[model samples]
Target: MVLKESLLELLKIKAIANITIKELCERADINRSTFYSHYSDQYELLTSIEDEVLDELQNTLQLYNHSDKNETFEMLQRIFEYMASKKDICQMLLSDYGGRNFQNRVMSITHQYIIQKWEDEQNILKSHSEYVTLFVLSGSIEVVKSWLSNGMEDSPEAMARWINDFTSNGLSCIPKNENSRLK
Candidate 1:
């Protein structure tokens, strides 16, 4: 925790470009070797933080699936709610805001969640499925960006309804063949 806090504080000072493992260890009062024992490098530490945040987000999403009737809308609500709770971490992650890499990360995670739920868990989505996953990924990124820019004043349930209604005719409910017809 000390080492993590030390690194986070340093990140606050400047972009990761200016920080060094030596300084991180010094601030944490941990041995340089101890830092190595825990994390391979500074990049590893950053990636670990991202993983930790993503795990929390995924866990919250899982809770929405516990009841069959409450999955989709609840999942959207949970996403905004959970992201609101981790606002600082998100602010750190999105500092560059909407960069290609960040967009890719969000899309990849959303796709993974959909695949895991509709395909792997229930064995429903086709083995060759790419169309729906891509649609959901693109749509979700756009939706999230809008919510973030708006300050997200809407309640999670209302956000969920917005997502549900938008997606109703947008992607999830549409057949893959219909998707091909669009483009």
Candidate 2:
């Protein structure tokens, strides 16, 4: 716990990639040996931060029931807000440590969000559910990544509306033939 606090302090000072164990130890008031005892390197330290963040996020997300599709919007906004809270860490994670793995993790989270909701609702459990899940997950991530990349110009509330609108329109576009069951 102390080490993590020191690491976060160093992260506030500079980029994660540039933070050496020696500096972390100094900031943390621990010896080099203690730093080594805790983590392998800076990458490991960042990974630990990621793990902690994910744990918190999961807990926060679990609080919301799955049946509410609107929670999807709220969740993403919450995540963005979390990132926004840690501006320096966000800069480092999004710029350096984060990449395809990050994107996959995000898509997986989005999928879980919807699947849980779908199960609770018991409304769309077909095998083709994967299609819809992937569609929403990927598209939503793309929108988020774009928002982050664009300096988060739009507030999260606005972004959620953008997503809700885009998704609702796509749902409306299913043709009459595909809607045969509805009739």
Residue 98 of model 2 has an lDDT of 44
lDDT of each structure? 0.67, 0.67
Q: Count the backbone clashes (under 3 Å) in each candidate.
A: 0, 1
RMSD of each: 6.9, 7.4
* Cα distance off (Å), candidate 1, residue 83: 1.1
TM-score of each: 0.64, 0.65
lDDT per residue (tens digit) for residues 1-183 in model 1: 887677677766567656788898999998999999989887778777777777776676656652243577777777778777766566556554212454566667767667666666556657644676777667766666566657767776776776676555554643357547565
lDDT of 2 at 133: 78
Model 1 earns a TM-score of 0.64
* Predicted structure 2: lDDT: 0.67
* Candidate 1: residue 166 lDDT (0-100): 58
